[model samples]
Target: MTRNTDDDGIVVLGHPRSGTTLLRRLINLHPNISSPPETHLLSACARFLDADMTADGVDMGVLAGLDFSGFSESDVLKELRQFSFGFLQRIAERKGKARWAEKTAFDIFHLKNIEKLCEDHVYYVAIVRHPLDVAVSCTEFCTSMGTYPSTLHEYIKRYPQPIEAFAMSWLETTKALMDLGRKRSSRFIMVRYEDIIEDENEIMNSVFQFVDEEHGCDQAQSIFNSIPEIGFSDHKSLQEKSIHKKSIDRWRSLPSPQVKRLGELLNPLLAELGYDEIENTGEIGTTAARRRYATSLALHAAKTNETDDDTKD
Candidate 1:
């Protein structure tokens, strides 16, 4: 469990709700490493030029000022790289975690910038989940409940399916990282969300070996056990594993239409990710699937506020 002063870091990337938080906690469990909360630092610091950078949090007001399309050219990306890494280096030093790591789900959406930040003595752990689950989770995220559709219909604007978008996004980002790994051959690693969920110890052992190999850190299970087992009380604890045996696959019970439609949408991505694409089951327009993964404490908070209002009346 001894800390190594060499100070290597890792960047954990996946789309929002795709298990990046869980990944951070698992890795931080290793004695020689540290990752403070799910720091969305990569996106914030990379956008520092046009962004009003606070100490840790990105200002919502500053974010609203510009669209993503307005980002600068290649010359600007290089400038932003130096500024972003300098800022992150300071943050990591402040954290007292000799070997630092950072987690941000949306960082995958900005793979190019993420690559730059980790170029200097850092590694990566990219996590991917099923696209259907991602869409269902994102639906709850964007609308606070699952009201998203899985299929495209004629005369219905023919919009891209949410599941499809999430799937394609996961594949594209992971591929980019893998491509980088092939070139560097010494700087990156890949992981799957399902693997972590199914057998955490095995996955953690693998990660520990990789980290130990990359950086000369002496690590053991005792140090990992020392990492607190924080439960998911609010959104904050998603970075820690929820103290529940939450199964990862909930789409099985969803109605056939949705399942079929979602299958159609994610088929290409499934193939790309080495997942078998299920055939449309002649049931492609139902709505029985819905996301219900919010922390109970959040629901309780809402109920408590409502009750307080009634008591005042």
Candidate 2:
């Protein structure tokens, strides 16, 4: 299970609640792969760099004001890269595995930075899920976590409701990462969450094969087959302790009005992802409603950041 100092590492990324955790656990079951809890390395680095550079000297408020004593930006980046490799490498070795994988939903925003930091030693596997399903899951999770929006109107304004935000995030993250994958071709792969749920063996085998090809190893499919039923407690404490088809079309149960609104906001992307959409529009219009929706979204963003900050503690 020994590896060269420059061995390739795997990265699993997705929109939050899009099955990234499940993928991590599934891949970790393989004898040759070591998957660990999210390090948030890439994300933290991206945020640091962003916070360090400010147009008006006040981007992240206090973060922008704080000064690093002697380290230059390049110094910071180099140190992060070294730490990332050192951490994952040690985990892999401890597990007697030849390869390591890192999963962080937040990494979805910093793919290019990650690529540059990992150099030629990183490979990506981006997972995508249906927007409706993602929104549904997000809403349920946030509510259970006590972060859900109050009314249907409020939900329409913020995330875990209005559902438009999830659609936008999914489309943006998927498109951006897919673009990176295509540009890097051999170094990146995109897997759909639905595909993994429907045909796990086939999708997982392909993932393992990708890892093997990149790392110059002939991995056996039996390793994947041997993984027992896996489960996880999401942010809401909802347990997905085993793989099942129960969640596949849960969005179909959504009210017709909400579904129509989602379709209106995300028609092209939904259609591209092979989901049904409502082609007609011209519904739900009013100045007051528009203002409320905008305010709701702004509040939602603030609340989301608050929750994220709390989680970091």
Q: Top lDDT: which candidate number?
A: 2
Model 1 alpha-carbon drift over 4 Å, by segment: 1-7, 48-96, 145-178, 181-184, 213-245, 271-274, 283-313
Cα lDDT of model 1 by residue, 1-313, tens digit: 3334343567776766677776776666554566656455676655553435578876443233443446434445555555554555565566564567777666665666566544644666767777667656664564653343222112123336554455455455656766766765565666667776667666766776766643222242332345453432115334333423364666566556656766766687678666568667784222422222245567889999999999999
Candidate 2 residue lDDT tens string, 1-313: 2334465788898877788876776787777778876777667665555544457665552223343455554555567777877888897898799778988766876766676566556777878887778877766766666654332224346554446666566667777877777777876777888888887767887887776633222332333345332332343312344566777777777656567776766778667766566555345557856777799999999999999999999
lDDT of 2: 0.68
Clashing pairs in 1: 257-283
lDDT of each: 0.58, 0.68
lDDT of 1 at 313: 100
Residue 34 lDDT in candidate 1? 65
lDDT of 1: 0.58
Looking at model 2, which ten-residue stretch has the lowest summed lDDT? 229-238
Q: Return the TM-score for candidate 1, rounded to 2 decimals.
A: 0.61
